[model samples]
Target: MASLNSRVKGAVMGASMTGGWLLADLLLPEPWGDVVLYAAMAVVNVGIGWRLGKFYDKQSDKETAADFDAKKAANYELPS
Candidate 1:
């Protein structure tokens, strides 16, 4: 089995997000029939997926979720 590359991961993530939203759009009642909003949502989702892939590229195999939690704790500390 081959490991997935970052670019593929990003593309897959972006496509999946867009596809999921489209599926929802088909099933749900159209409250907001704005095409621009839907387009913007797809762009934002793709951007997030791209960023996630970049983040994955920077990670080391030895890194743990606890390390991520610690980083988050430092960066997003609640106001004292």
Candidate 2:
């Protein structure tokens, strides 16, 4: 499994791959080829979105945890 940053990098690579395929298809004559390329591009885009959502969820969880910890500390008292 790759890190969040690596996953984003992979997504960027996927975009370039799709671009290359599109260009190649344009150079050659094949109507259905474009459809296949578009489908692949859509899948990559979905994956990228899912990965980004996961990254944001993780950050939110950390922030929530910190907020809870701070509140707990503020409520605590010590004997003199």
Candidate 3:
């Protein structure tokens, strides 16, 4: 599930960055357009990295909790 979410997030970011670059190229001129496009891409990539990090952290926490729960369950024993 986390993997799926990450893939979808990556796809969306890639598409948006491409679209933004195209739009900037059409609206701006020459060096300025290229500069803007690069800057936008850099910022978007940073944001994507940050988001993915958080998502992975959350997924890890869930997995850790599940493992702990399983260990506790295994250690339990009923009275005879």
Candidate 4:
């Protein structure tokens, strides 16, 4: 199966965070201060998700490169 793209992953994470905020607000409405706090938290959540995606992408690239190298080595034939 195809893996989720980095942007898609970040979007999913950010969207889920927004949904959680909505649900929490509905359950317990807060004052203006909390609203502002939540907004900041939402931005922070999105940023964290983006950074996580970037980190994962880097790790995946490294793993892929290592696997390719291993496969190439496995197929190497010494010259007679």
lDDT comparison, 1 vs 4, better candidate: 4
Ranking by lDDT: 3, 2, 4, 1
Best lDDT goes to which candidate? 3
After TM-score superposition, the amount by which residue 61's alpha carbon in candidate 3 deviates from its true location, in angstroms, is: 0.9
**TM-score per candidate, chains pooled:** 0.40, 0.64, 0.72, 0.57
Worst 10 contiguous positions by lDDT, candidate 2: 1-10
- By summed lDDT, which 10 consecutive residues of candidate 4 come out lowest? 24-33
What tens digits encode model 3's per-residue C-alpha lDDT throughout 22-78? 887889888888888788878977987899899999999999999999999878956
By the TM-score metric, which is better: model 1 or model 2? 2
Q: Name the runs in model 4 displaced over 4 angstroms.
A: 1-30
- Pairs that clash in candidate 1: none
Report the Cα RMSD per candidate.
12.8, 4.5, 4.4, 6.1
- Candidate maximizing TM-score: 3
- What's the lDDT for candidate 3? 0.84
* Residue range 19-68, candidate 4, lDDT tens digits: 97777666765687577767877788798889989999999999999999
| TM-score, prediction 3 | 0.72
Q: Model 3 residue 80 lDDT?
A: 79
> What is the alpha-carbon lDDT of model 4 when measured against the actual structure?
0.81
Candidate 3 has its poorest 10 consecutive residues by lDDT at 1-10
lDDT of each: 0.74, 0.82, 0.84, 0.81
